[model samples]
Target: MSMPGLSTGTIAARLNRMPITRLHFRMIVALSLIFLFELGDLNTFSYATPGLIKYWNLSVSSVGVIVSASFFGMFLGAWLGGWFSDLVGRRKALIWSTAFYSIMSLVNAFTTDTTELATVRFLTGIGMQAMSVTGLTYISEMFPKDVRGRYLPESPRWLEIKGRSQEAEKILNDLETEVETYLGRSLPEMRDFEPVQQSAKVPVAELFSKELRKRTIVLSLAWIFVILGFYGFSAWVPTLLVQHGYSVVKSLNYSFIISLGAVPGALLAWPITDRFGRKQSLFVIMFIVAFCVIMYGLAFNETTVIIFGFLTAMLLQTQTALLYSYSPEIFPTRIRSVGTGFTGGLGRLGNVAGGLLVAAIFNAFGYAAVFIYVAAAFLMGGFLIGIFGERTAKRALETISK
Candidate 1:
């Protein structure tokens, strides 16, 4: 099933040497919009929870059940999305998942009862996670090893793996031509290299094989704890603030201000991920965010609460962006999506458990206890990755993962 002459190595070399062009910018813009929509939709239900509690007379337990349902859906979606992407191609998977979530989000607006709303939210979570998982994998595959990011165009590396070398070549040719025209000069000469031989299909069980099992465990644990900590704080903060005596409007406003910090937090990772290295940067951020979470919990005034909360949100998002880049790089091209998906799916389970944990801790021990629990999760996640994660910065995917 190998391409007669062309190989993955040649494709990679060509891609790696190409200079950035307007095409890369366009793809970045498109992928950023997709992520923006996905994150926005993912948080919609959380923002609506307080209003729903008042309007529908829903209890805290009911809210937990509803949030848990959505996360369960995300669990299924992450696994299926990765499997589907590997089976078909990233572009088709991305399109289908995006459409699925977008339509479901619209349907969510029409739901009236608790049962109806929960069901729709569950469906929406599937699409949201699917789109997110696919986007991450696509970004990892399409861009140079050092400059990960996405798009409509299928990954030439993926195409070559699927025995579509001719198509992959054509796409690469188009990219080369586009870059050449943009630069008003030909690209650097591409060097032919040995192709990596990959199976046409990789079974899911391969993730547990001797060579991959350690990676599987490490990545899964990282995803699970980080997600648990993130959702624990983000999903409950507004309601928790309201419970702590802030007006609903004031809580929402503070949440909005804290969220603005996320942009810069994510941006901060761009330079340091390569310079300081992914594992180091992520580890430092995670521990710092954990400390910030604890501080936010202990803050007695509006000013301290907002300040600490803003720091937590910013650093948490930085951790998120780094993970997206790190996850796919930990696997080979043949099983990249599935590997990322499997870990991410497990993380969704953590999200599910996080909801219940928040409700229980808040009900039994109060607001500060809940933040302490979340901080612990972040600390554990950081410890796992910092101690065990492979160094991936500035390394080629094949060299890093292989």
Candidate 2:
């Protein structure tokens, strides 16, 4: 299974030295479109819940159940998706998840009852979560370091981990040859950096070994709390505003305005992630989200509420962009997908709890109590990462694990 004049190490060396080309940009854009549609489908519940509640005369608890159902599926989906990615391949995992979710989403549009909708949403959740985990894992494996020696190394390093050096070599050579064709020049020869491939597969239990235990615990907690805070706020913003005396239309309008902040926030986090490091950036953004959300709760006027709401949305997106990038970087190549899946899967617990908590709290104590709870969740997530997170800005994934 050898390719002439190609090895895993040589592939990595060549890929690392090649420039970011149109091919890379196009692939990222394609992936982004998939992410966009997935996000759109996932968020439909929040927007449609009010109408469903009125039409069905659903109780708060029932609404909460509908909201939380997908999260349970997400929990299982993420874990299994990670395992699938590691066992089968990223492309196949991604394709299956995408196809499954797309069909489920169409079915969801035709649901006639809350129970039916909830069931469809749960199935869609599994596909959506699995796709997300696979996407993050794939990107980390495919991309080279953004800053020399500061981010993930090329895919060859990870391919070598799975004893797929031949495939690794082919991928790298294919990428380099494509780029070379575009550039009308040959890539420079370089020495390989990967060690020889190992024969054994990485076990899931290895993520909890003595070396990664603390990181695993910290990351699990952080994911749970961060996701709790993020989904809690985003899922209920419009409803919370309505409860605060704004008309339903006004509440929806404000939510739309604030949601627009996500695009800029994502754009802004890119350079900041490479410059300030993932952990610190996440801490600052989450802390800001806490502040802004608290302020949003206290605002008496539309102008103030809109301003704070926009700020909160922006900062939350900033934190999310970093979180997605940081999650997979903390593990070694052998178990990257598994570790990512496990942590992310646990975060769905928070998502489920957060939705239920928000409904219970809003029903009893009102919007202020909800924000206070959300603020605490964000602050706690910030504290965990700030105190214990590793510095992974300018280092290889393998180096960071040690």
Candidate 3:
């Protein structure tokens, strides 16, 4: 049965019917559902990893490599999903990715060994960013120009500008400064930010052209480690909790507590990120997450465990708010979803890598070692944000993608 999909004109016409901001409301449902689904989807793997390993007698390296397989699918899907979404529209991608992953998730339950499991996960990853990229762009489309044109008045632009008060100019300056600052520190200053510059008028074909190889590199670096870190720790949380001498019920309970934290955290991320800027907001959250991860590892008392666990959830959930809010808003309307899918898809590579990384360290080093590794991942995320991420508060897309 097909439900009527609204045209942009139709949607725009009915804007008054929406009780909340359509963009926010769409993201609230779409991103939140995807987050919850992926959490459960990844957790299903974690819960089943041990069983699969024992049943199949798979080696750690084998599982690690197998785990990464899903990323291959996600990589293709993410980079391409945006294009597809732009070509068709935002809504289709969401419905398709969600439907695809939902079905693939069930398929995972029937897996035999690393091969079959990876295959299923791979298919699952193909749908990984369906909701993410499209949902992001939809938000950008829904908001008022006032929301788009102005940087939060008090928001720190990535670079300091003197005397520029025009909100759009301020935003452009912020984007430029953030790009320059990141390139100044991390990248060789060999090439200036042509992509960032051209974003103002660069066409999608031009943005994705051979001339802009550097842009692709910058984008890849943006999402990889941070994503890997977040997913790696999360994928193993249920397993780690179980290994902490907690029963399955307790382990599930702990994970539930963590997920619940993300709900409020997600809400917090939108306004704060909208006001402060993405890079700053992310760095702040990552720092606190690092601390929470360490606390989660050492805490033994029930109260301490639950408390730290909730903190971890808060940090993780904030992604739903910031990542989704930020991703699509950074690209052109034509290619917004594509850029989002690509980056998000690239992030899933980290998820695949994290799964394997945790799997490798789990038996060899111990849960504590695994978590420390996770903490290191978060630390890298913080470092990367401090170095590369621009403050994106009050900034809109249309030019950021190029």
Per-candidate Cα RMSD to the true structure, in Å, reads: 2.4, 3.1, 12.3
User: What TM-score does prediction 1 earn?
Assistant: 0.96
Separate clash counts for every candidate:
0, 2, 4
Model 3 ranges off by over 4 Å: 1-40, 43-66, 110-114, 145-219, 243-249, 300-302, 399-402
The candidate, 2 or 3, that scores higher on TM-score is: 2
Q: What is candidate 3's lDDT per residue for 1-402, written digit by digit as tens?
A: 121222211222222122233334444565556667776776567566545545677655666676688777777677666766666555666677778778887887787666787788788877765655655565555553224311111211111111212432443344445544645542222211111121222144644666444444445565776677676666567656665577767777777777678668766775676577666777777878888888887786888888987888788768545655655555544455666676677677666666677777887887677767777777776776666654455433323444
TM-score of each: 0.96, 0.92, 0.70
User: Model 1, which residues run further than 4 Å from truth?
Assistant: 1-4, 149-151, 189-194
Mind giving the per-residue lDDT tens digits that candidate 1 earns over 148-210? Answer: 621278988778778888889888888888887888886766553537665678578989999
Best by TM-score: 1
Question: lDDT of all the models against the reference?
Answer: 0.84, 0.78, 0.59
Worst ten-residue run, lDDT, model 2? 146-155
Q: Considering TM-score, where higher is better, how would the candidates rank from best to worst?
A: 1, 2, 3
Q: Which candidate is the best by lDDT?
A: 1
In angstroms, give how far residue 278 of model 2 lies from its true place.
Answer: 0.8
